[model samples]
Target: MQLDSQLDSETGNELLRQAWVQFSGAESYTDYCQYWLELMCTRIGGVTMATLVLDSGENGFLPSAIWPEKSQPDEEFTALIEEGIEEASGLVHSLASGSYGVAFPIRLDDELAGVVALSLNVPHIVLPEVMEQIQWGSAWIELLVRRQRGKEQTEQFDRLSGAVDLLAAVLSEARFQPSALRFVNELAAAYGCDRVSFGLTKSRQTEVTALSHSAQFGKKMNLIRRLSGVMDEAILQRGVISYNAAATDESQLVMREHAQFSQSGGNANILTIPLHSGDDYFGAVTLERPVGQAFDEQEQGRICSIVALSSEVLRNKQNQDSSWYQHLYRSTKTQLQRLFGAGYLGRKLILTSIALVCLFFTFATGTYRVAADSVLEGEVRRAVVAPFEGYLDDAQVKAGDRVSAGQEMSRLDDRDLTLEKLGYLSEGAKLQRQYEEAVANRDRAEAKILQAQLEQNLAQLNLIESQLQRTRLKAPFDGLVVSGDLSQRLGSAVEQGEVLFEVAPLERYRVILWIDEHRMADIDNGQQGRLILNSLPEQSFAFSVSQVTPVTEARDGGNYFRVEAQLQDISPGLRPGMEGVGKVEIDDRRLIWIWSYPLIQWVKLKLWSWIP
Candidate 1:
């Protein structure tokens, strides 16, 4: 007996777990109600004939789902449901046939949504406990109704938003082919369709217009022909045709072409909706998805709504994008309608205002300018050279440092020169003494030779002293150090005339403009322009073209010409290698020409090259 009881307990727990899963995961209200009713009757141990009655809007209170599948509700069951609705509460009634019935009214959002009724056949069951259990279980049904309604409302809102997006995407394009292509592609992506094709009716026959994800298609292609046939089938029926490969039973509508097309596309599920504008059907749109992802009733209705909303807009675009003569005819017809048709006074006023504004702008004139990349460079760059071959002893300044005209930039070692000077001075002193001796002895030849040696020694001493003075290199003028850094190599030897530091004057600067080779014709030496440097963008400097270098430099996959310009006024922060943009002003021209010249030039070049 103990083992049996344990087994029974486990079985009941398993059943409860399953019931919760099914109840929470129910997709529709009917499924939820049916599952809930079964669980309630089984757990409460109640009786024969249980039914779930819900409000059916126009049909009044009716049974949404029934328990025991085949069981019929007796007259007493009907009475209990009516009584529950009337009293707006739970009811326990004694039936005329001696059985007892319990009814629980379910209220959602404080309004009576439905009622659940059960008939108890066992007389020994506690009536109050059964009534309480029924009432408690009604809450699950209420929750199910709320969740189902919320899901439905969310789906509706999403469909409405998608429709608006589709319409906007189609209407944004001005030409008919582009608009139709956009419409089909949007529909395909929004619905998860593999292919979406649109076709228009001409002379009672259908011609495929635009296909999703394809820019062009040949009419002689087999797939296009099949798609055209499918569209024509929908148009002939003048209604929606939906075909599922899994469904075996054929409906009343003829779908021979749809079946063939589906077979060709790996048994894809197809849905085609005939498109109508005003009172006539003029086109059709066919959507195809995978076999398992069949279009449901709600999805089909949403797609139909989207197609209907965009049909008229696509039609207008198509008419406007016809051949030249047809476009002219339609444009003339539209203008005539606006001029003479009733209730178009607002449109006429808007058209007139737009025309007047366009006329005024056509006559306006504006300055034309050619823009080019420019960089600032000093007028003259001066290089500070090493005066003699010597080792660098000390470095006081490097690149980018401002120096005076005679500032000591670097120093070379003068120890060797100092030693040489001492040797020369001692030799000169000895030679002088020898000359004095020769004079004292009255030796004319010795005196003359000693005097010559003394003079030669003096000249050597003078040369050594001069070499010592030039050891300290100095800046030639007041300017910024443009290049050369020697702080890292203080003891390194330098050759004679080797440049050490380059300095440029701060007061004079030139702008080197890199103009495209194509635009060199428009630029001249005297044209005036303004420059804005990248480093100092807040200030603008006026400049004039000085010279144009005829040499072409290939850079960044384009040929550019180097043009030199002179800055009219020097700024405080101007430095070499400051890059900026320069715009050279040309003569005044019409506003239309200023805006359309580039396009016209490109077209002319293309035409000239293409002509044989």
Candidate 2:
């Protein structure tokens, strides 16, 4: 062999022994690969060498060692090493810096395990023995990769076993809150985490429920808020968030919050996993670690797998905690077990009664009415507005006053108009005297000027008279004053076009039903309905739908369509602006559906939104 021709048998044998010892003694694959690189540079003449290995941990090929111990290869030389791996036979050529370059592909079974490169500062053919020497050295590299793979498999098995135990311990408890607390604490200990926090969403906000190593925490604490903010980021994004954890693979989140938090006091590495069941987001859990011990892809993946298994427990427990209905259901179930359980006589009676009621409700037919809040109004509402800007002299009518057409509802102060009219009258009389004087002198130009001034004076007098007439506001139609009452302020300044009163005829009243948007689809014009006013609850007023306004208005935190229905029989006591509950009959429906159709529709909408 070429190695035999170059080196004596004893020296070659000694070097091979040293290479094996280094491979076994070194703590990491990087160190083991470097040992061979140093050996080749010292033993082989005129060469600067490097050893590289495919690190699955990094998802890339990494230079295990580059000599002269400080220098790194340029991009071109690195590219050559990559190219050499694809070749059937290795290549040797002169480099840009006048040195010969050789790259050898190291293979394990069928896979190109790594590449070894050398730069020789001489013009010489690369010997077969040198390639053979590397062939021998590559065995140690293969061993390193094999040992690492085995160690990883063992670590993964251990992580999975611990995860199963962690989940089982929490699942043993029937209650969710305690189980969640146990989950965080046990997880912190199992993974050597500095802190682990679990949170559940309440009223659209995620609140931290349990903290590792602490049973209780302040809700308003800044630290908790900061932690919640981190979890919230993950929940809103609908994904996992990690920061400063691993260099090999990066998380998809920006993780700016983590960076700021990490800089606050201690280790900044954070992992947030959002827990969800179907479309409903339950909350999230955050794990923190100190500096120099960030979680990598493998550790993060292990956490994800464990969190996915325990998420349902957290969801169910939190739901029970936040919902009083769930608590009531559970209590009733417990009580029924005690009274109507196995051999109790009451149990049989209750079951029979329930069965009979269910049968009746299922088969019986009834009128189904869609109920909404209604307000009484005139068939035609007329607004009394100020004809022009003026001070209020008097408000004779307040709300609920009966008035006839042309009746004075309110009067603006006409004193300003009367004084201005007297001034205009004086100007008109003076201009008329000037016109007579000019006509007598026969000064044609002076007479024409006087005529123009007289016309201007007449125009001013007419405008003032019009203003005085408009000062008193009179109703256009006979109606009851429904909304406005300006009796207390005798001289309140009023702006032009300002409405002073709303009038509607008492005998011709309309009902404005504020129907919820959810039930809008069932309503149309001419639908018959009945109303019961809050003031007079004993009597039911019949009405028919006249128009369903297309516009939606917000009231009491829900969108409602204003439906106007004319009262069929207007009562003398029934007044505009009076409100009560109104129900419109949609159609005849089963008794059970008549009572439960709203809930059924709500469920249908929710299912359609989330499914598929």
Candidate 3:
């Protein structure tokens, strides 16, 4: 019997612990109170419980939420609620239905929050421990209400900050129309509103830009017209208009349109804010929430601030997206007004600076030069070639190497030629001995044939000797080896008449200027120019145009004409293939013309083509 009693006590303690835990985690005050009543009925053998929160607006307690929502409060428990509410302190009352009841005055620092009433189904079961536990649970009622209120306030702040940040971010990234659409959708979701719509006023008429929960909505829809009508009312009043919900202070204008719309739309709260920049009323935004959750003063202020911030962005973006001609005309008119009329000092200073620059360019004069790409080349280029088909025996020089008149550039093997020469000589000697023997034997015909054979053999020997002597390649003049590199190939075979190296004389050089085809018409044979080599950038070399090739070459996406020029001063160190910029002196002209010629020419060509 003692063990059974101890077990029951442990079970009851555990039940109370769970009940306290559930009470602390409630999301809202009404939800927590309703949940607590249900917990008491099941755990403490209560017949029924009721939760009533005082409605400050009506000056009485009203039921917010009830658990086992279908359950009705017994008359006995209901009767005690009014008595409990009247008392500023806790009350425990018993009814004639053999039901014992208890009530607690839930307070947060002396302010009554609500009343929690519970009645025991079995009066005899209301032990001292049971009553104490019920009171223990009631202690959390004030704390739960405070926690929920603070959490909601915190959430409100977070939502406000997030809405502003999102507005700035999306507006800065997108143009007018898209930014407005995105802003309305995000704003509605943040404030827990059922619908959000944005409208812009142009020509004294409001046009809907976007509506939340709908991507492509028509402005002529009945619902849109109603929503837009609300915004129009707000704009006419030049202040915020709210309906189906309490405002901080009511505006003088009547909200008849909103009343009709809300009645048809099922008890929705609507707040419309008109946006303005200076004298221009740009647009407005309408936020709509359901009956239970209405727009309060704090949210109204937030919406107004957000609309004010976003109005400038939308206005500027609309101006930017105007037609090009309209923009130009408006800008010209504004500028004319500013120049003749009063304007900011900064604008006047900028205009003055621009005018001064224009005057300077129009009247200034200086020498103008038509520039082109140029490369240095030898006046006379010499090519070294193989005398005959032979294997390369040795190479002593490559490209860019200096060589004297008699210096060996490369050599071909002479062993094969020497062997052929020896064989021819041996044949000739044998033929001569045969011819002498024929003459001693008085054989004139045979002697003559042998003599001709010997002559043929001697000629063959001469040919081979010539070939062997030509195998050693030597420079013909004192000059640098401009091109060719055979150092990597020692025993490679070369074909006859093949070019092996190119040598340019040290004393003379020419410049090849690749002038653009368009500027080539201005170039003549005698035009003088100066070249500054990329390697020798410190000095410029003067040259006279010697020749202009009639051929046109296309390279690097442009047509070029090859114009050759002879250098007036030749440097020994100046090698062929040295490239630089060459500027040909054209006749003098105005500084503006020289600077604007390319642009003017381009415009002329475009106009000529377009006119045709």
CA lDDT of every candidate:
0.87, 0.82, 0.78
| CA deviation > 4 Å runs, candidate 2 | 1-353, 437-448, 554-557, 609-612
| Backbone clash total, candidate 1 | 0
Cα lDDT tens digits, model 3, 212-251, are 7787987787888887777788888888887765444356
- Candidate 1 Cα deviation (angstroms), residue 501: 0.7
> Could you tell me the lDDT of residue 434 within candidate 2?
88
| Pairs that collide, model 1 | none
lDDT of 1 at 150: 89
lDDT of 1 by residue, 384-409 (tens): 89888999999999999999999999
Error of 1 at 360 (Å): 5.6
Best by TM-score: 1
How close is each model in CA RMSD to the real structure? 18.7, 29.0, 17.9
Highest lDDT against the true fold, candidate = 1
Query: What TM-score quantifies how close candidate 1 is to the native fold?
Result: 0.47
Candidate 3 overall lDDT versus native: 0.78
Give the candidate order by descending lDDT: 1, 2, 3
In candidate 2, what are the lDDT values of residues 435-467, reduced to their tens digit?
999999998999999999989989998998888
